[model samples]
Target: MTDTKTVLITGGSRGLGRNMALKIANKGLNVIITYHTNKAAADNVVAEIIKTGVNAKAFQLDTSNTASFDAFFTDVEAYLKSINKTHFDYLVNNAGTGIYVPFTETTEAQFDDMMNIHFKGVYFLTQKALNLMNDNGGIINISSGLARFTFPNSSAYASMKGAIETFTKYVAKELGARKINANVVAPGAIATEFGNGENKTNETKRGLVANVTALGRVGEAEDIGGIVAFLCTEDAKWINGQRIEASGGCML
Candidate 1:
């Protein structure tokens, strides 16, 4: 019943997810973020958003575990009731991890991990989320530039992202009748703690990425959050089933 819009972001304890949560909150939307293990970090993000004069909370979620999603949504529903809202307005499937093993060296466990977290998790999570999402809402699926362009030792990770891209298109198509828009945002090499902070800490890797990017520098988390926030706005109502790569023209 509340007039304020709400967004649910997964893996928002840190990294790009954290940035997106904060940016979305700054746009005057309430935020519910999910964290895998870092409760303190998630709580900190919530506190920061509260200071921004928006209602924000963090919940624990293991996106890779499908069995837990039902319970997760139950908690979400209770929280929504407490806030005097029936459904959320946006869903950002952003929880993920990186594995740098080469295709030949990639173990079955690693591949399955990638599939569970990146593809399957996003797939079913979105499916279940529909019941709790408002009509005319939006879904933003996070992808990676490696999905479009090849990269050494990233075959497994990139393949899952490619699957998400295709899945997001189908979501957009099928959900159009409900007035919900689905889109994917693929970020270029970003200097975040993702992948163990290699891009942020390794000067050689940063330099290499900078050389290939048209912007002449590796992307920061700040570079990507606004794009996700924009998609949730009324201005992006017509933009559906699209893949918007925030890569600074890498490999172009």
Candidate 2:
């Protein structure tokens, strides 16, 4: 039961990010969330987080807009100054886009889109955020089980995720002096709007993924949210530069 601290989660407007914000906010942490589009949705998430009697707010952010990372960091610093908080305790680099194309059909544009969103964005975002983060703060990059397992249409996505895991290790090693911890969370196929439409997941496909899982059910948003929340707690203070997979043994 560590003292509640501030947490910033990107793409926190809906889907897994929204769920994670709710879970973290309920634990008495101040939530500063970001969304790429849909200001209305971001506002709704903020309202929900506040309903739990915790401090929460949302901002517009496009992670793929890597050129704006510095400006975004400035905005975050300004927000922190307004709140009189010196440093934030957690950063979840959860904002990302998905692409599904056969290896033969995947074009250069498609490959670049996935790489920019998943790898390049996470890389610069963490670099910018580290300066503003508190000592002993935690960073959780959202990877996917595909990083380790082979998936036909997910070559690009999985490759980027693998890159994230490597980046986490490097971040952890370099930031050790500050007591900062960086880690990755690899989730199995979950029911989220990540790969498809907004707020709509492929129920049948998700169920099939669950059937292959040891748990016999697709993962819910809360399933991953809860894990991310825990990593910020003192209980995980010693866990750094590691990849924790919450896939119910999927593909095992």
Candidate 3:
């Protein structure tokens, strides 16, 4: 058997990312989470995962800024060496924030933020990480259900997810030589601290979402975490270039 697998997740200080880190740790994968400014919260997550008996660490990463990726990976490599490893096993591109602006009202800055964090960041991060990913390892890019169904104020964000879906397919195809598989995980409306906590705090919005969702409510962060963890496990080895939407049957 190989050494313990490690997963690098962006934006894992809290919310769905936090839940995913914990769930993946429960499966015996070492975890490395990135936070933009919440080092305290990120440290807390590391501590929580350590209690699960898996190795964990947190690093500062602003996913939107490509200029810092080189330095970021340098630190990651140093950390991996300290653990007697040379590469990570999986990459989960989950760092991002949602902007609630209509298409007409969306500014160039808003569009760029969405593009940088969702598409460009995922694209280049995976490119650089490929050097450090084990053969036959996998990648999971976080998309959103909005890419399938329409929602107000999400045009830019959804467009990027659509791009991710397309990019993932290409990654799977090109990386076939290396046996590195890539897939997208598109989550439906989830109740988390993400996106200013709209799904969690907007009671009227929650009522409307519940009316349309077959599951009768917005999805919890826990609902999506396990699916991500499963993809990182051996059971999902054959799954590649697939867009798995964990949206609890919403808008169906």
Candidate 4:
């Protein structure tokens, strides 16, 4: 039950972030979404959210480039103050990317990119955004089920996701003084640009994942989006620092 009411979602141009933005905006909440590269896609999402009779906008952001974070926060602060506001209500660190290279073949550049985008970005962005959030506000970090399972080529990527979950716990502890909530949302085998139709191959091992999933199919972006929206709702105030997997029971 926060008085300051606005939600900022990273990677909100497409996939799960886009769906989450639309859902929250439909509930009459102010939304500020960020995109790494796809401006057109972000604008499209903003348009859809506005159609729901709510306020929503998109800003360009590169999660891997942490140097620009301060400027981004500055812009967000200015926008909120213009509306006679001082703090945001929630933050969703959903911006991330992936590379399907074996550990032995993974280059330094690739490893750095994944770590920067998945872990470092979430860490520093949260640090910067926390000061601008209101009491009882929510913080959600998007994780992957690959962090829990043994997915060979996903070692580097999954390791970063693992770090994010751990970081969420510490954030919850530190931000507790302000009564803000922080948690992790892990999704399994989602049908997104990260590794959907384009990356399909015989060697891409998701057979075990598919066979073990009780839902009998991979997840869609909206599946995770809906869960994220629920987590930020008033009903989810007690949920903090926990990893809630929206995997449809993938691998039990």
TM-score of 4: 0.93
Query: Candidate 1's residue-wise lDDT over 117-179, tens digit each?
Result: 999999999999999999999999999999988768899999999999999999999999999
Between candidates 2 and 4, the one scoring higher on TM-score is 2
| Residue-wise C-alpha lDDT for candidate 4, range 1-252, written one tens digit per residue | 234368999999988899889888866688899998889999999999888776777899898888999999899989887777888889999988878789999999999999999998888999899779888899999998888876678889999999999999999998998989899999888777774442234334456556779987777777877788887789899998899998889887
What is the Å distance of residue 182 in model 4 from its true position?
0.5
Write the residue-wise lDDT of candidate 2 on 1-252 in tens digits: 234589999999987888889888877888999998789999999998888877787888889888988888888888887777767899999988787778888899988998889999989888888889999889999999989876568888888999999999999999999999999999887778788742246666666676778888777788888889888788999999999999889878
The TM-score, computed over Cα atoms with residue i paired to residue i, of candidate 2 is 0.94
How many backbone overlaps does candidate 1 show? 0
Per-model CA lDDT versus the true structure: 0.94, 0.86, 0.93, 0.85
Alpha-carbon RMSD to native, per candidate? 0.9, 2.2, 1.0, 2.2
Per-model TM-score versus the true fold: 0.98, 0.94, 0.98, 0.93
Count of clashing residue pairs in every prediction: 0, 0, 0, 0
Highest lDDT: give the candidate number: 1
Q: List the candidate 2 regions with Cα displacement exceeding 4 Å.
A: 1-4, 197-204
Ranking by lDDT: 1, 3, 2, 4
Lowest lDDT block of 10, candidate 3: 1-10
Task: Work out candidate 1's RMSD over C-alphas.
Answer: 0.9
